[model samples]
Target: MSAFVDTLRAEWTKFRTIRGWVIGTVAIVGVIVAFGLMPGMQGSCGKNGPGSECSLPVGPGGEEVTDTFTFLHQALTGDGEVIARVAGMTGIATGEDPDKPNHTVEPWAKAGLIIRAATDQGSSYAAVMVTGGHGVRMQYDYTHDVAGSPDGVTAAVPRWLRLTRAGDTVTAAESVDGDRWTTVGTARLRGLPPTVEVGLFATSPQHSEELHTGLMSGAMGGPTQVTGTFDHLAARDGWTGAAWHPDVIGHADGPANGAPGAEGPPAPASGVEQVGDAMRLTGSGDIAPAVSGSGGLGVSITQTLVGTFVGLILAVVVGTVFVTAEYRRGLVRTTFAASPGRLRVLAAKATVVGGVMFVTGLAAAAATVVFGQRVLRGNGVYVHSAPAGTEVRVVVGTAVLLAVAAILGLGLGALLRRGVTAVTTAVLVIVLPYLLAMTVLTGDAARWLLRVSPAAAFALQQASPEYPQVANLYTPADGYFPLAPWAGFAVLTAWAAVALAAAAVTQRRRDA
Candidate 1:
């Protein structure tokens, strides 16, 4: 054990003594910070400049979310219930020419009955709604969504929705005939007050469709407005406040309740109108988690770490050279002579290189994430704030990712015995797939590449989650991954472990 420790110490000494390797490692941090803080990544947010700002509403769970909708509400006190029949839903989508638009309802457009803590955006709420395509659903707080009947509503076949509140629990139910109801789901909005807003709401998120031009791909979308017809609206038990009041929550023209940093320009006028026995509500925007794409405010913390790829290249090169340089200089024979166990020598080299890269990556990633967000905001960009835990994982996961890549590079260096060849192979297998997955490939081709390739490990940097309930583009370009963070890290760890094992066997069977 002491000899192995001595071997480890010697390897560390040799690594630091090599000025080129040390410089390369330092360059990793420099490149990561430089690319992360690069200028011209600005946004229209806070156009007034540095101190100006734009921000999204933070939900009950502290996640940035979209809470815009046209609400026709009445305040309810204590335990109560609100019921409404969604008679119909319709909407229009933007076309190439502003003069001509398509009359169509986006699949996720919602018209529902909600029991909210208040009219304020991002307040705790539970709702039962009929969607344009997803049928009936019970959604709450931005992230929680539960599906009901797989059926759309129409004037002739309306869907009846109900929300009953008792203490902190809100139960949602749906019915086909309004006579018999089936429980859809329930949500516990802890600490909900006695006085809450019970209302009918209508909202439509941005309408987007994949745009494929040959090998390249993108999304083309624009704001859309949806109108829902509701009849037989009734409130039972503990109802208060004046008659139904119409207000646009999270209006783009101004912040909710005079809060600063409104999201965008005024959307199409959203309001409620009495049409005979039914109320028609027209609204634009969404009541869902904010994600990165055509629908989101701007980018996520993952955007600040875009330089990880470049830093990874530098780290890989340094790791490869750490081992291959010794072989090229005929120092491996001396290393093996001193530490007769070839495996221990390889282990020592791996530990030294991995540890150095880990520390370097940790510093670079932490600086990039911490200061890069400031740079983004300084340039008038709205960066979604990640939860503290997610931020820590992304920062630490980034370090681990770089460390594993470096170790993998070391193994390749030992096997190939050529720095250029090993570095090229490492980049090809790790980085090229990521670039291709993000740009050239599309659909399953892109997802499969990310799923199987070493690039899958980059999932570690994905700070924003992909919620099944939110209808947004969940693509690699948007910083979403097919694999979970730790799962993706495990893939790279497995690859490195296999490579080191192969190098060990090759080292023992052949001359040093």
Candidate 2:
């Protein structure tokens, strides 16, 4: 351990003595900051900007959302549950949803049940329902959702839905026969009143063309309106079995009381009707990511980290040259002579490079999250940040990304023993693949590229993800990574480990 300490000190001294390398590190951080903050700085989102025309609703933590659906609900005043067997669920899209102009049904259209604070926009809520092609899901508020079943809407197979409330906690469940039940998920609404609105609902978001337009342009959003038919309505304790009433949320033109919608008068439940023991509910709207990638909220530094590759690429160059330059200068012989352990020398170099890059990355990410939102807001952009813990993860995850990249660079440098060749290799394998995936590749192709490329680690910085409950094309082009955030980071880490292992073996076996 003491010998390793001395080796680390020696490596650190070597790295810091070079003014050009130190300057390069600074420049790398500068590149990340400048590029990260530059893209969304001018997006319109104040009173008349891109997202200002229709002020999307906000959820529990002020998360930006679009909630404009027709609802059919009844009042429930205490702890109990509601169960309904849905005979079938289907929908149609009008010219557009809630406030937008549209006609037709989106593929991801939905119909289900929800328990909400009231018939007001931005209220806390939870629901269990069936979607167009995505299967069963439990969605809450405007931000959280989870899948329950892989089987989606089918005429042949009817589905059962249930929501149970105990104090502030709400649990959603689903069943096929109404005898055997499976838990879908659960959520808690803080300070939820004993009395709440509970009932059936349906909605559809912008389909292919309109969604594409909204996502690509980020300035206009007139989603496809949806109508769904439901049946087999039933309820358990706590519900008075009173007649259900239709309420609107997210009207586009006025203030909402229990009246309906966000900005306008009550939504037209043109498709809702009751037949025998079943009721059909049709509604339009969405509760998911906004077109601007901010979810109509402010832009987060995490999502903006896409541009950090510029800094990371420069770090790769610096790291590669750190060791390859020594080889080019014919200094490896002296290094091995002094240490005798080639592995220790490599470890020392890796430690120095990795440590410095980690600090640089951590600091850069910190500054971006801390102040990037302010810059966006100054320019009329509204960003919704994650909880404190997620913020910490973004900052630390960014540092880990840079540190691993630096180690990978050092390994390549030692293996190739040529500064230009090592740098080129690192950039080609890491930076170039990421750029292609983000820009030129199609959805399926982009996913494959990101899965294998070291750039997959970028998922660690994702603040926005596509929800299956919401209608939108969930692809890499839409800012959703194919792999989970940690999974993507692990893929890159695996690549770095393999490269380092090969470098160690070659350094030990070959002459300096």
What are the models' TM-scores?
A: 0.93, 0.78
lDDT per residue for candidate 1 within 255-313, as digits (tens), equals 32122343433456678999999999998888888887544457888998888888888
All predictions: root-mean-square deviation over Cα? 2.9, 5.6
Give the per-residue lDDT digits (tens) of candidate 2, residues 67-170: 76778888888888987766665554333335443333455566788888877777888888887777788888767778889786555888888999999999
Residue-pair clash count for candidate 1: 0
- Find the 10 residues in a row with the least total lDDT in model 1: 255-264
TM-score attained by model 2: 0.78
Candidate number with greatest lDDT: 1
Clashes of each: 0, 32
Quantify all predictions' global Cα lDDT against the true fold.
Answer: 0.85, 0.73
Distance (Å) between predicted and true CA of 511, model 1? 1.9
